[model samples]
Target: MPSQNEPAEPLAKGIIPTAKQQFHDLFVWKQRVVITNEYGETRTEWVTPEPLQNPISLFMQLSLKGWLYFLVGLAAWTADAFDFHALSIQTYKLADHFDTTKTNISTAITLTLLLRSVGAAIFGLLGDRFGRKWPMIANMLVLGLLQIATIYCATFSQFLAVRSLFGLFMGGVYGNAIAMALENCPVAARGLMSGILQQGYALGYVLAACANLGVGGETETWKTVFWIAAGISIGVGLVRVLFPESKQFRQKADVDESVHTVSAKMFLEEARLMLTREWKMSVYCIILMTWFNYYSHTSQDSYTTFMLTQKQMPNDAASRASILMKTGACVGGTIIGYLSQWVGRRRAIVVSALMSGFLIPAWILPRSERALSATGFFMQFFVQGAWGIVPIHLNELSPPAFRSVFPGVTYQLGNMISSPSAQIVNAVAESHFVTRGGERVEAYGPTMAVATAIIALGIMVTAALGPERRGSRFELARRAGDRVEVGKDVEDVVMDAEKPATVQREKMDEIEKK
Candidate 1:
């Protein structure tokens, strides 16, 4: 097989394909070359259009240890999601409890989102440098405590302050959770696992909606949901204490001990090197994630409000619809995530976006409970269906040495940029009014529909035009007797030592030269 860095074979007579042809190739299914190394690690390179393995058998390939890692990651992520949506789904109740408008209460959401990037940067580096375990443990435990703090805030200002602190810790979860989850998964099963893992967010939403529905629509009942979220977060943190560090992380540490003295200076230098080389890809991922954050937040955050104001539904009914909407999100994320393995990540995302865009009219035009619930379900199915591909897609694009930091930072930065999505939706919807049954009402349905439509188009264009690294390798351990020098050609060193060249070395070389 050819080196992964080699240029693609020419189409004919050494002629390179045009941009249109390259775009067309994004949708074409290709045969893959599966290569296994001396360490028993395997990677797949797309070659030509041909059938591959059955999806079911691909899922069956994961080891028992891989599943354990994936499940713990999933639990942490789910707890994080529940904590966030607990507030978002109860916007009205919170507004009423604090004696403020819904738009003002949304400021708390904004503050939480705005500061998440800081947490991602701090904890992500810690995970990359020290280990994934302790930083994550601290993040989860603190988030639980903050959730409790939210329950005690007697004033709106205090509420916003607590949520801002919440965002800091919440930002840390995605990077560490995903790195632990997918890094150990078999390459063939990654797409499926990625789909399942990303839905922890949607599942969190579902759980929050259920809690809201159970507690009724009283103004003070939002605190009950917060209490539940607190328990889940703290419980997941304690459970994490029972597990060992990620197998890949442990192996890499062991190898580093023999090859070179692992030091903070060495780790920082490597991190700086990765940033220098991957700045372009980093910018692109941030842009992609920004659109995605908007895509999910715009469509889902204000949905219950839309049903309450425009469609004239009761709180219990709106809560039920919200539950159904997120349930669709969970299902869509998993199935499309599985299909991405065969159809390719970009293709799956683009197709899902297009489908969701078409469904916007049906999503917002319905008035009856049954109609709204059905439309909401299918709409989120495609909305979050596209989201299902993100976790693994970001991981695949990340530099090998900084998987935790790279995906975490980019994703949270996107959250930072799109922090005002809900505020924007609320502001626009409240300012504008539509005549309903001879009375004026907030125009939430139109605002959300238009925003979702535009975001879906943005997602399609960005995903189609962007790059992919579907089967990149993650193993970082080296053979005994290999030595690594800081700021040297690490790839060449490993090659000279008679070991297979790693993806990390290739990335390190590119960064070092720059």
Candidate 2:
């Protein structure tokens, strides 16, 4: 098999096609080029640079159904983020409510992280085997109920138990959402859409911050945030019910059912093949995700306390900074995600990581509240900007048969590995102190700054060596659909052209077998 970077096989006149060319014809992205030899003999060549769609017009080309599909995934993911962060943003109040240390409350967070992989494995297999629709709905409904349950927890153990179960259900949402959202998306539109989709996480964080601000950050009011998160999650489930299974999934199902029964055995075979083929890529993705989780948690999680305690800033000031940073994350994620379409995935991630590293000083060293807020904005901007590419990047790299399970499992495993980040930072920072306004507090600035810089460098290096599958087809049928859609003047013309040919081919194959 040709490597991802290798060009497509060169065509020759009156020559039978090579095996590589035959494979390329079915899958990889291709472009036409004109070449002239030294003897002035002109020939046409096909090259593959993972062509990009017209950025401005790309989204406009998505049908109404496509937009709806994308929105459902986004809403589900956003709700997932909202429910998770609802607890995170209110950790202080919860610590007080349970009469426990912050570290104990963090144990709940860790429990949630640890159990997410269990959810991913179970729900991911269900999603791949059955369909993405109902599993996703189930995941969200359970998550909402758990959020409500969280509101009624009278003890820390009860709270931790609810959160642990919540983590399991929460893990189910990500794989299914991205699978539902981007599976039918045009390859060209994926980068831009991926950026927007990943920001749903940051957007959820922003919503949680707003909810906290609205509720005045008191222990009693924290329950209200959970209530809101529950509502959002239920609403997500209801909205998803409006759509059918994704087009790519439906197509894949049609193909699978024709060949063999869809069963656990099929899933197992596919998983085995995928792991054997792309285990290295899977390992690399998990590592990248580990660094990413650490990057986000370390930079944001403890920084609020750092502001309120070490910098002697007001709670309002700290909240304002958090909101500003998340807003930057949303905007940056979208922009960098779109840029990745042209700049290439690994390059975009590396550049963003390096840039974020350079801003660490300004991000953490600022004494003034205003300056810190501004630096925090730009800091997360670059940090999450790089993160924006992840959804599509992972999807593009995933094996077609195992798309739902592969990305989710790796991401959750990474979350599990990075679960200790906040505690680690806290333990390290306890020994350092800073004095401001006659109050001496545990210093977090240096620790966060140094940790972020190191993580950023690690991300840059990891991404630089990772593969790029920018314009890979989402499913086999997509190739025919894309070809017809690309040059057509009318949107309806594509289905009309491809459907009969597909039917005829199926008919001929069946007749031949008979």
Candidate 3:
């Protein structure tokens, strides 16, 4: 194995091969043949653990600029999530308001998830070709407009149309926000920051919960929630406008100009190269994301209904249990994310998934509200702990030139594939309904537990077999080269850009030689 401080292997004159080349070099086909003795069973282990570091020291070293970039991404993602969930949580209200069936209203949600990949492709390509700034600005601005439009929508068709457009704009935000955030982050802080950044989704849900509560969770006041969401998103966009362009993007633009002016044609060429060269990685990522999305939706979506109907818990108790679960998700994601830096990203995720498997019995079989809440807390701790690694993991594996699009596209595609998760779980659980207290109750607990256990195992296996580019450089030049010299910081590119003409020339020569 290469040293942690060393660039990934297969670099020559600082140029790394395409994804296809890397896959070819790394691919292995191994038989499970092993000798089993009374003493022990032996098999090959694939883990390559990273070095350990102090938790405090890890966070203390981040520069202010790094924090800003990370916060912006987190905030935008949080707001995006908030808006989406506010609508989802008010599904019953919306159905009543529009005088449609809940199933009909759900079609709008499906449209959003279904068309997000289209949005990701458009915005992600634009962000890469132009810069991460204005594309994101437009995405956020459009999301706010859509939210306002949704509030005024008179007919069910108008509501669906506006929301479909919202999904398009919402899809664009993830790539640009993540690109702007992690592109400028220091490699050392990425794991911890990523964990925190990803929790924005959960945080958004929590905020939506608050909004629902603030407005009495009534069908008539759901429009007010949309208004609040719009204000927040638009406010985020205006603030984003004030932030300067990320230094890494500027450096990439400079390199593109030096080679040939960056254009849509160049973006298309990069896309072609990425899809053709990294198709395997791309497919693998989408599969992992599909399992992940299903895991999340199946575990949480029907859980409250399960608590109310199956477990006979009161509405307040079920709500409390949900809150407890989300809190655990937030805390667990952060801790595991930070720990991944020392333990390795893949290892952390696999461990979290495996640990989650052990908690299922406790999570689902509890009879009392208190026991249920406690179990739910620990259960989500592992489920979302595994999830916390996803954003950074995807970003790290993505091609440097197409990092923005690759992660977003893969993520949205996975979301699209798993869009029917809630429906599937609900249907399956209904079929397994049990007669308890002379009433037919949906078997949500057993169904969820079994499904989650399978997902956890799949996650473990997928993560174990997948690649890791821990400490990978994010800048365009180093990514093109696929090498970062040991002990050298990519942030130095910013300083290089500010150097005198002669010094800059010498640096360029040095880079060319390396």
TM-score of each: 0.89, 0.83, 0.81
Per-residue lDDT tens digits for candidate 1, residues 1-514, read: 4455323433321113333444666765663344445444655445653245686787678788878888989999999999999999999999889888999988888999999999999999888776788888999999999999999998878899899999999999999999988877887788888999999999999999999999999999999999999999999999889888886446455333543545676566666656676787898899999999999999999999888888888999999999998899999999999888778888999999999999999999988888888989999999889999999999888876677888999999999999999999999999999988898999999999899899999988888777766766654433222236555454443333222235445543443344
lDDT of 3 by residue, 254-308 (tens): 3334433334553465467667767888988998888888778778766766786
- For candidate 2, the 10 contiguous residues with the lowest summed lDDT are 477-486
Relative to the unseen true structure, what is the C-alpha lDDT of residue 113 in candidate 1, on a scale of 0 to 100? 91
Model 1's alpha-carbon lDDT is: 0.83
The candidate that wins on lDDT is 1
Ranking of all predicted structures according to TM-score, beginning with the best and ending with the worst:
1, 2, 3
Q: Candidate 2: which pairs clash?
A: none
Residues 350-450, candidate 2: write the lDDT tens digits.
88999999999999888777898799889988988998999999887776556788789988998899888877777677778777668777878988988
lDDT for position 123 in model 1: 91
The predicted structure with the larger TM-score, 1 or 2, is: 1
Error of 1 at 69 (Å): 1.0
Candidate 2, superposed: residue stretches over 4 Å from native: 1-54, 251-260, 477-514
User: CA RMSD for every model?
Assistant: 5.3, 8.7, 8.8
Worst 10 residues of 1 by lDDT: 9-18
The candidate that wins on TM-score is: 1
What's the CA error at residue 358 for candidate 2, in Å? 0.5
lDDT of each: 0.83, 0.76, 0.73
